[model samples]
Target: MLRFFRVIAPAVLLAVTLAAVFWGLAIGGAADERTLLDPGDIVRYGLPLSRTLVNVSIAGLIGSVVMAVWALATDRDEYRIAMDLAAASAAVLTVASAATIIFTYIDVSNLAFSPDASFGAGLAQFVTEIELGQLWLWELLLGASVTVLAFAIRGRRSTLIVLIGALLTTLPLAQQGHAAGASGHSQAVNSLLVHLVGAAVWLGGLVTLVFLAKAVSRDRLALLVSRYSTLALLAFIGVAASGIVSAWLRIGSFEDLFGTGYGQLVVIKALALIVLGAFGAVQRQLLIPRIATGERGGWIFAWLVTAELAVMGIASGIAGALGRTATPVPQESAQDLVGSTPAEFLTGDPLPPELTFSSYFTEWKFDLAWGLVCFFGIAFYLAGVIRLARRGDRWHVGRTIAWLIGMLMLFYTSNGPFNAYEQYLFSVHMLGHMMYMMLIPLILVLGAPITLALRATAKRTDGSWGGREWIMWMVQTPWSKFITHPVIAAVIFVGGLWVFYFTPIFRWAMSEHLGHQWMIIHFLISGYLFSLTMIGIDPIPKRYPHPFRLVILFATMASHAFFGVTVMTGDALLLADWFGAMGRDWGADPLADQKTGGGITWGIGELPTLALALVVAVQWARSDTKEQKRKDRAADRSGEAELKAYNEMLAKQAERDAKVGPRR
Candidate 1:
């Protein structure tokens, strides 16, 4: 019965996916007279089919690799099976991505396929010169590369790297989906990326499990199922959240949920998700515990998993069609640009109201990615604290408060007026940078999250690496030690400011969303490392002496102040084209704003510097007190033997001097 179902699963996915594709094409008017008269049926039908193949193959590739790392001991037959699955899937992905490139070119360029020399040249030009072509080409190349790597690499660390590579391959596709000039463009892109990756992990992991069903030992099956179940839970949350965001962007209102073809497809997908979630809940809450206790639930678990996979196929099919379906609320509306200012055209939103003191607190521009990040960070940290408390472990309340405050500050800086105005005003950008690099990190370091994690997380008796193991491995690595060095961390923190603003990197970050995100990550990490070196209570490779740390701090402060002063006094504007050409209606003059930014660097930057110095000073005093108490304890333990020895030596010296004085 299990064998029959295994054979039937792939067939079901194929039949359902093809049926959904055709159904969606009909409903969404892909073959409408308008499109048929131009690109015709080949593009209308073939493009979405090829995209479906691309998505499924990519999922198989990523899911197999991730599962191999998270489970599948190296010596097990299932391990080899998982890697072979990854390799085979990568091969499929390579072919599908190549086909997707060709089909996408035909759809986008409205050019017929040809065999002439000019056709070859035009194809080359398309891949090299056009952004859409370049994206698919990159995906093809990444898929091909992973295909080779997956076959050759068998070590856990190497496989983990390949897993990351597979995830990165999805980014190009995500970036291409949203029009850059559309409102909520960043949010759409972010949500799509999360959606694609989450779906891949969830779908792909299930497929791999079914493939290895016979090879896995019955005893080990429960363990793999338990681990994969946790991953599925995370993936479920990610998919649900990102799906809602994507739907909101496309449908615009609840009324459109049933009113439009796109919305109807979204509703179908949502239903499939709800079904999958229920299956997942049953597996996690009921079957997994029974299986772990050596109960004969394997057959029931298998049937449930098979049903979940079938539902996932339906969702995947719907998603492929959704990619081609036209939405009633167009992402980029003509109405949006009817009376748009230059700022609106450039930023995809109208110029923000003029900067005011209260606006900093009141205004908001929520970033989906960072907002989720902050939310997760706070939730997880609090969970860790609660876990410790429930176990009768004492965790400092102060650390929890500091952690929450830091996350709140991070949320505000990334989503508040600072982010909204950063593009238009240089000074506001600096303010955001300062908070990201110095203030927030300093507070977070005080939270001692690492300490909490070590105490809170369970130790895995099994050889498989878990969160605790990975954290310890990372902290113990030579690279981590080098980065956490006081000198190295200080250099990165202080030097990044000059390197970023003075170079073309600043302009790149302002112009490109990915670069902007990288900039934030870099500053935040560097700041966290520097602060950790100075005042962190968590375990690290080494700690510097108080005097040397003070020296590093003072030197960093001086260099930071000098950079700010340079920015303030300089006549030339940094990123002259970006901030200068924003055409903002109300704000400080560009050059004056540049100076104000510089002043922020010099002036506002000092507050964090002073705070760090004060923290270091307090830590230094405490160290002295600790040493004095240690000596006092030693004296009490030894009965003041050292003092008694010194007094005896003084008496002998006096007696010898008295005898020598009579001879003199």
Candidate 2:
């Protein structure tokens, strides 16, 4: 029966996605003349009045809710009962709205053909016309049911994630033609929905698969994992291919691909996916088998998965560009940058419109180079301290510092600087963002508490009382509170991305020697928040109970997904081209480019976030198991030692001052 599911599950999933894709294309390509309204009538008004939000209500809202509730029931295990309840509730709320939401879509889709009516009305009519009937209601039930069953065999989050992906197929029925991104409405709805689903399935499933595999046989785990991995790979390929093809249509030509700011950004995103795919291949071939071999292998596999998951975050940022507009060229725009001196570039004035960090350092501005060097030198200094702490009480501070210095120099001499340059110039910004937000933080968590610091500091009792008290207070008071609140960290994670991309200050971050510095900041801020959110090896701030944390995580993801969709749907330029005449020299339309960027951001961006959220929950739950074992061992040791010492002390007291030496 399990084998039957193993084979049938993926096949069924692929068929649904493929059928939905084709159905979308047929009507989308305009082969079917029975649209909500005639193009001829709409063209008279010169507007694509077809865009609507109802599609999302069907695919994301309805489908997601159903999947969530069903997952709750299936995931009702000893470890996650509360999680099951919350998810089931969410599913009830989201999926139960089907009757109402589906009616809204059908009403809009069947509206009469008329260009004279207001554009808003046309949009409404089109959305209402999409038939939301028994088929979808039943389909939603089946998808959620399958998801529940899948989670039963697998786990909770993994089951609903399967539905997340499966739910997206319903978009076509909402009158969103196959080439979804072509129409802004389709793009808006699917932008975050598709990727969110895929990421949840891939990243979350891998976490489950890898850990479960650890307790079982290599061949069994391998075969089971491989089945899922194949699904993930296919999903990734589907998203990438669909994205590229959609981009080609939206962008029009090669000129639009690189000749414009938005186009170049998309190209960079494509390249990043290629690189991630390359690394994924290496991980699959070299690492999974190694991990399946046993304990050490499992650790290595954990790292490999960490690295892969980390890259997905970076990929998400680049993909966010799909919702942005191409930089526009205005009348009377200057062709060249207005920089007169070195200081001009530093001030973000007279800089080229297309200026990037890597381009600035070469022939553009040599004066700022040394400043970047000094900055990295400082980061190395900090890293040295952390590395020293990594060894706990086992190593000397001086040796650790020296080791870090050597690593820093090696980092500079090898491929580090080049990669840093790329990051500053393009999607590298997002990559570094991931390192700060996810990878390095995870590394720090695994490094554990500063055992050496605690020990050495314990010997410093002769030092000033104020300093010691300060350190004590730092640990006992606000320090943990500042980082541990899940809401606080979630805000930072989502907000930092918003702030960097939405301001003129972002340009400053992109240029000058400060570009790398800003990247470092991004990495640190994100890393700090991410580590706090996940199961770090070190002590965390006040953690919510597992049930609460899982709920919050799910809500956090939903909010951000909606945020991306909002960006995709709106017709606005995020950054506003604060570069004066330089902004106008780039002929493309900023609003359209931003919409494309936002669409991609909304649709695909949540994938990594959702994946990370689920992984964190699973890892935290698993850690609870390990922690119980650790505590049991420590308690046993302490008990034995106390008994031995109590007997010895009793003998001494009996011979001397007696009175029951230390209470046993």
Worst 10 residues of 1 by lDDT: 28-37
Candidate 1 C-alpha error for residue 430, in Å: 0.9
Candidate 1's TM-score reads: 0.95
TM-score of each: 0.95, 0.33
- Root-mean-square deviation of each candidate, in angstroms? 2.4, 26.0
Which stretches in model 1 have alpha-carbon errors above 4 Å? 1-6, 31-37, 292-296, 332-340, 645-664
Cα lDDT tens digits, model 1, 1-664, are: 4566556666676677778777776766664646343677787788888888888888888888888888777767787888999999899989988888878777777788888887778788889999788888999999999999999999866788789879988988898878776777777888898899889999988888888766766667778888888889888888999999889988889888998888888999999999999999898888777764645566776777777777887888788888888887776632356876666676666678899999988899877778788988998899999898898999989999999999999999998998888888999999999999999999999999998888888887666667777788888989989999999999999999989987889887886778888999998999999999999988888888988999999999999999999999999988776788778768778999999989998999989988999999999999999999998898899988888899999999999999999999
Q: What lDDT does the true structure give each of the candidates?
A: 0.85, 0.44
Q: Please give, for residues 1-664, the per-residue lDDT of candidate 2 as tens digits.
A: 2223323332343343333333322323322244545434232111111111122222223323332332122322311432333234235423543433333333435443345556455544434453333334444564455345433534433444544534543433322222211222222223334444444444444434432433345554454445455556755654565455446545667786767665665666577577667766876687657655765665565555555544543444333223323322211112224433332322322323343455424422211122223344445445545555676625545544533453343233222433322312222334434434544454444333343334334222322122223344455567557766777777777777667666666676644223444555665656556555554433444656667666766776676667667766775544343222123334235555456555555555556556657667787778799998987788697986866788999888777654445543
lDDT of 1: 0.85
